[model samples]
Target chain A: MVKSKSWTMVKHFEGLPKLEDFKLEEKELPPLKDGELLLESVFLSVDPYMRPYSKRMMKPGDVMIGSQVARVVESKNPAFEVGTYHVTNVGWTTHFISDGAGFQSLPKEWPENLPRSLAVGAAGMPGYTAYFGLLEICNPKEGEVVLVNCAAGAVGSLVGQIAKIKGCKVVGSAGSDDKVTYLKEIGFDEAFNYKTVNSLEEALKNASPEGYDCYFENVGGNYADVALQQMKQFGRISVCGAISLYNDSVPATGPYIQTYMLFKQLRMEGFLVTRWMQRYPEAQKHLLKWIAEGKLKYHEHVTNGFENMPAGFIGMLTGENIGKAVIKV
Target chain B: MVKSKSWTMVKHFEGLPKLEDFKLEEKELPPLKDGELLLESVFLSVDPYMRPYSKRMMKPGDVMIGSQVARVVESKNPAFEVGTYHVTNVGWTTHFISDGAGFQSLPKEWPENLPRSLAVGAAGMPGYTAYFGLLEICNPKEGEVVLVNCAAGAVGSLVGQIAKIKGCKVVGSAGSDDKVTYLKEIGFDEAFNYKTVNSLEEALKNASPEGYDCYFENVGGNYADVALQQMKQFGRISVCGAISLYNDSVPATGPYIQTYMLFKQLRMEGFLVTRWMQRYPEAQKHLLKWIAEGKLKYHEHVTNGFENMPAGFIGMLTGENIGKAVIKV
Candidate 1:
């Protein structure tokens, strides 16, 4: 028998989730059954989707839903051998048990130079999301201008870099000056602190005088409305996340975009990373090659200790962290 | 030399367009040069796009921009012989001299049974808008549910019928009970008067218990926001127009759709009919076949005389026309 610690939802989040909304509890696991494997969580991921999705899909007293990179401690399943790393949605847990179903084993030849924590960060779901959303949804062509909101965060950072790699002029908006600087350092053609800008429209117009050909939407609301107006004819928008509205106590409202969308012939598509589940390995391989070739870079804002998961999650929602927000147990 | 009477924009539209905003002026035509043809306007189109686009694209002294089906009275060009009809964006003109630069000749073999006015209506831009917007953008599969707003209008009416032809259940919303009846008579699976519905969401839920797989948005604003919430996972939206906000005195605003779109993994694309210009003849052939086989039907609300053009335009904007609104000259 092994003792495992986990965070459980004690109450449904009303607006911004508080630490009291979750309860850290302990459970004693019985011996694993024949196809089961015991997992020890190495790093847990906290993302924007968890906030709104919890209110919609989760019930009180349920194990909080999240993804993590874990090591196989004991395995009866040959597919998930002991000492191999795997990514699983085992929530905010220090340990878990899985039957190898819904578990993705890390590539056997994962470059030793890269951090294993990337299984939950870049080179993982966030990386794959930026890959497919930009390449597939936006289908950006070389010499086109691409704009990303919430840049310096996991997905947005990767989106800008990937657009650059594809020969696009990349512009990004971040919440802080440090983030703006970081984005510029990471090869964004232009980076602005959205919070300090007098007008988002002015900032965007100044950044890309010709207008954007592709928009990677992460921070929705008024920002999205402004961005929509600045899009060139036949532009494409990938609606990945709406972090600005995830914790809204009131229903979110913004300037109607139909008129602009219609005249410009814009295509705005909303998507989840899971839509490309079948092609995960393909994306993973390309992302790995990009990283190894020095064409891609990744950052992780990691908080140590399992007990600090709630704080880490709250900080991420408030834009307190740059890059992928993760908890190292 | 011949005198041609034309409507010219005297002032930009303030709220809703007024008759005095345009000046009916007569101009003496110059002699046709080689490759030029003399055109006599037969049918002029009055569409929702004219209202907003006029203000955006037209200068105060420019002719009111519009498309018209014209008879080639005298042809210096071999391609456009006398008595042949063609569609040209010659504005609100009773006669014009065109060099055939932007003119599309009507199909060489005219269906004697179908009205020639259709060359500017159903068989024209509006019809093709519905065809490509639904089939290409929404891509409705068999057994799916489709919903169209402004359902009795030209594009929306065609959208519902096309969805039905594709083996999808069709639900529609129109402004009046008569329009609803017209939609049902045209083979819509379900139709509703949006004004009478206590709750649009409830109306949608009752109409499509399984939720919609595709949404053809012709009316935007509160209706679009409500329809978005009723969409099933992985639904597609084809945004053709937004007549609801065309004459808005204030900027239009609606509920933020990013959260719903993200969770449902929905795709909403806005398009102009011109996007399918390269494949126009292909779509026109399919539409003509559907009409000839009686699988597709068309209705036109025609206002007589060229002078009634403004009234036709105003009436259409106010939802007075049941189908494609046009003016017979």
Candidate 2:
């Protein structure tokens, strides 16, 4: 028998998730059955989506819902041989027994120089989301202005970089001055710290006076309303996430955007990354190529140890992380 | 010289528009120039769009912005000869001198049985808005559930019928019980008076137990928020208007819809009829064919006389009109 350490939801979050909401527990795993593998978590991802999704989809005593990069320590399954790496929906467990279901093996030709943690961070779910959401939904054209909020984080960071690669004039908004500088360094034509900016409308006006053609929305609420107003006619908005409102106990209210959307003929679409599961490899391939070409950059804000999962998750929710937040197990 | 009677915006609207906001005046038209034509108004359209668009795009003393069907009384341009009928942006006017620019002549092979006034109503901009917004944007599929608000009005009425023709289950909401009955008579699978319903959410849940696949949004604000919650994953919303909130001096607050949209992977697009200008004839041909086959029906709530333009427009905005609202001058 092998002992596994896991974080389980002890209580549903009320406002911003508290450390007491999650409990670290140990479980004993039996020997792997035929077609089953024993895996050890290498890196665990903490994303903003977990905050709301946990409340909606999970219950108390359930393993905290998440994705992780794991290495097969022992295997009875022929499909997943021992010593292979995988990206799996294995929750926040340090060890798991799986039948290789809901898990994707690390690409066979993954660049040797790339870090293994990237299997759950950049070049993973967040990267794939930014790739498809921006290209498929927004379809930014050359010389067109593109705006992204939560600009220093995992998905938004990649979105701005990808827009730049597509020859778009990219503008981004982050929460801190440091993030703004980082976003500017990563090819954003203009980056503003939304927290310090007196008005997002003025920041947007100063950034792109002509108006944005495409908006990759991560921060919804008032920011989205302001962005919608500044959008050029027939603009497109890819609604990826609403990190700003994730922890709100009460629903936030702002200017009714449908008015601006109608007069401007704007298209705003919300999407989940899994919608493009069939085309995952397509995005992964392009993302890998971009990374190899030095056209895309990634950053990981990793919390060390499996016991620190709750801390990592809480920190990510409060915007303490600069990029993809992960717990190194 | 001809004396042209026109309504000009005397002051900006405060709450609901009043007769005092407009002034009826007469102007002397100069002799027709080489490219000019003289038009006698036959039918004037009163629409919900003019309520907000006028405030944003027009100035005091400007002619109340509108579209009208007119008979060409005299013409110096060969493209438009005397006796031809045209739909032009001549505003609320009894007679006007136009340069023949931005004017479209009535279909050359228009059926004699169809009223020429339809050139600005059912078979006009409203019809085209419903066509492209529904077919191109929402793309309702066979057996899909489609929900349209303001279902007895011009665009919403047409949207429900079109969705039915596409083999979708159509549900609609209107303000009055009479309007709801009219919607059901026109092939809606279910109809409800939103004002009578205990809760819009409960109404929607009862109407579409499986959840809506397409939403034709004519009434924005709270109605939109309720509809967004009941939309199935990957649902589409074609936003045509926001008649509900058009008259509000203060923007009403509702549930921030981005939360539901993201969870459902829903797509909501706002549109103007002009977006489909290139494909106008295609939609017009289809609409005309449907009308001839009796698959599509249109009702015009017309207030006779040019002086009733304000009344007709106000009535349409307040949900008093059953279908396409127009004025016969």
Clashing pairs in 2: none
Model 2 backbone overlap count: 0
lDDT of 1 by residue, B165-199 (tens): 99999999999999999998999999999999999
Task: Give the range where candidate 1 chain A is weakest over 10 consecutive residues by summed lDDT.
Answer: A246-255
> What TM-score goes with each of the models?
0.97, 0.98
Clashes of each: 0, 0
Q: Model 1: runs farther than 4 Å from truth?
A: B31-35
Local error of candidate 1 at B251, Å?
Answer: 1.1
State the TM-score, rounded to 2 decimals, of chain A in model 1: 0.98
Q: Candidate 2: misplaced stretches above 4 Å?
A: none
Q: Which predicted model would earn the best TM-score?
A: 2
Top DockQ hit: 1
Q: Give Cα distance to truth, residue A108, candidate 2, Å.
A: 2.7
Local distance difference test values of all predictions, in order:
0.90, 0.90
Query: Per-residue lDDT of A1-329 in model 2, one digit per residue for the tens?
Result: 89999899998888899999999999899988899999999999999899989989899999999999899999998998788999999688999899998787899788999988887776899998999999999999999999999989989999999999999999999989989889978889999998998888999999999999999999888888788889999999999999878888899898687888799999989999998998888888888889899999988898998888899899988888888999887
